[model samples]
Target: MLRTITIGSCVSVQGLLVGQMADGKVMVRVDEKTYVGYPIPSKRAA
Candidate 1:
């Protein structure tokens, strides 16, 4: 299934999680970004 996986505010309007990188950093396509220290859920499955 395809679900919207967002990094809260760590991404931008032009950013995208284009698969994961080798170092675990999500390959995002963006110019600048904003970071928000929010609690991210570990799992969203119910």
Candidate 2:
């Protein structure tokens, strides 16, 4: 199933994947909350 995930902190999801930083976790933001996850990124944009 596909879903609409939000940008956690300021990490780049479509351009950059700078590995954990100040926002040391990948997460899903919805309704003012964050949920950590190991995003299985399919492909990146140009």
What residue runs in model 2 are displaced by over 4 Å at the alpha carbon? 1-25, 43-46
Residue pairs clashing in model 2 are: none
Q: Across residues 1-46, which tens digit of lDDT does each residue of candidate 1 receive?
A: 1123345655323344445546444444444643222222348578
User: Model 2: which ten-residue window has the lowest total lDDT?
Assistant: 12-21
Candidate 2 matches the true fold with a TM-score of 0.32
Q: What lDDT, from 0 to 1, does candidate 1 have?
A: 0.39
**Strongest candidate by lDDT:** 2
Q: TM-scores across all candidates?
A: 0.27, 0.32
- Model 1 regions more than 4 Å off: 1-14, 31-46
Which lDDT values do the candidates have, in the order given? 0.39, 0.43
Error at 24, model 1, angstroms: 1.2
For 1-46, candidate 2 gives per-residue lDDT tens digits of: 2323235545433323334435444544445554554455557698
Q: What's every prediction's RMSD, in angstroms?
A: 6.9, 10.0
Error of 1 at 3 (Å): 13
